[model samples]
Target: MQANYVFRVTVQLDPPTAHLDPDRFETVCRLPAATPGTDGWLFFQYNLWRGDIADADHMQSLLMEKLGVEVIEASFSELETDSAYRAALESEIETDLSRFNADSVDAVVHQHLGSSIHVRDAEAIPDA
Candidate 1:
C-alpha cells in the first residue's frame, strides 16, 4: 500500500555549530503511489532521469523541506516498495496503458523508475 523514496543527506556544521550531534543522515519519505497517468504519478517519471536526480537544485529544495535543515549534499537512494504494493501498482498501470504510452506494465515501470526500484518486505522498512 506504500512506496517511499530514500535519500541520504549531509549537513555541514560551521565552526560555531561544531557541537551538533551529527552531520550525515539517511531517511525515507513516503510518496504514495498515485493511480497511473495522474499528475502525482509523474513525480518519479519527471524528476528523475537515468537513475539520477534530473535537477540538483530542485532536489536540494526538496531535501531542505523534508529534512528541515540546510543540506550540504544529498543523493537519491531508491524507491522502496513491498511486493504487494508493487503488484497493486502494476495492476493499476495495466488499466491506463495509453497514458504511459507503453505496451505493458513492465515497460511503464522501467520507463519511470529505470533501475532504481527495489522490492522489499514492508517490515524491513526502518522508521522514518
Candidate 2:
C-alpha cells in the first residue's frame, strides 16, 4: 500500500512578483500505486516517453489542477516501493505472464519499469 510513483515537478508563479524568494520552485508528487495486473500499472509505458514526461500539456493541466499553480516541468523519478509490495507485485505478475508477454516476473518488471524501480525495506519508511 505504500508503493508509489514519485515525480519531481517544477512550478512557477503566474505573476513574477508573487514571491520574492523565487518565482520558480521544486516540488514532489507522489502518485498512489496502481494495482498490478491493471492497465493503470502501465503508466510509465503509456504516459511517459523516455524518462521524461511525454505530454507536457496534459501533465501541466493535471499539475495545475492539483497544485493550483503553473507547472513549469514534470519528470518521472522512480517507482518507490517496500519489499512487501515488490513481492506482491511479482506475485501478481506471475499470475498472468502472458499479459506482459514476458516469461518471468523479472522480465515483466524490467520491460515496464526499466531501472526506475526502487525497493526499500518496509520498516525504513517513516510514518507520514
Candidate 3:
C-alpha cells in the first residue's frame, strides 16, 4: 500500500571544484540550505514514501548523482499525517497529492526535493 511520508534530509557537500566556475570552493565543502539555520546547515523536507522510501544511504547517493556533491551527514524522521498536519503542509508546501504515489525513494526524492519544507515520517494512526 502507498502512503504519504515526511522526510527530513540534511547533507554536507563540497562545491564542484572541477567545474571551472570561479565560484567553486578550494577545499571546504558547501551545505546549501534553501533556508539555512544559524549554524548554516541546509535542511530539506519532502513528502516521501515508507515501504519504498530511500534510506539515508540511498539519499546520499542520489544527491551525489544528481547534484555532484558528496553527502556527509543524512538522517530520516517520520512526520504525522493528521488533519492538522495535512492542513499545515498544504499551507506550507502546496504539495501535489499525487506525489505520494511515487513507487520508489528515487522517484519521491527526485520529485519533491527543493520544493517542500522539512518533513518527518510517522506511522499511520489506526482508523477508529
Among all windows of ten consecutive residues in candidate 1, which has the lowest summed lDDT? 27-36
- Colliding residue pairs in candidate 2: none
Computed on alpha carbons, the lDDT of every model, listed in order, comes to 0.70, 0.75, 0.39
Residue range 1-128, candidate 1, lDDT tens digits? 55676766666544564565565554444445554445576677667765677788888887778656776676767778888777877887898789778899888777767788898888875545
Model 1, clash count? 0
Candidate 3 TM-score, C-alpha based: 0.25
Better model by lDDT: candidate 1 vs candidate 2: 2
Residue 53 error, candidate 2, Å: 4.0
Name the regions of candidate 3 deviating beyond 4 angstroms.
1-10, 16-55, 66-68, 80-128
Taking the tens digit of each residue's C-alpha lDDT, what string does model 3 give over 18-99? 4433433323222233221223211233313333234667766765574465556444443224454434434433344354
Model 3 scores what on Cα lDDT? Answer: 0.39
Best by lDDT: 2
Ranking by TM-score, best first? Answer: 2, 1, 3
Error of 3 at 9 (Å): 4.1
Q: Predicted candidate 3: what Cα RMSD to the true structure? A: 13.5
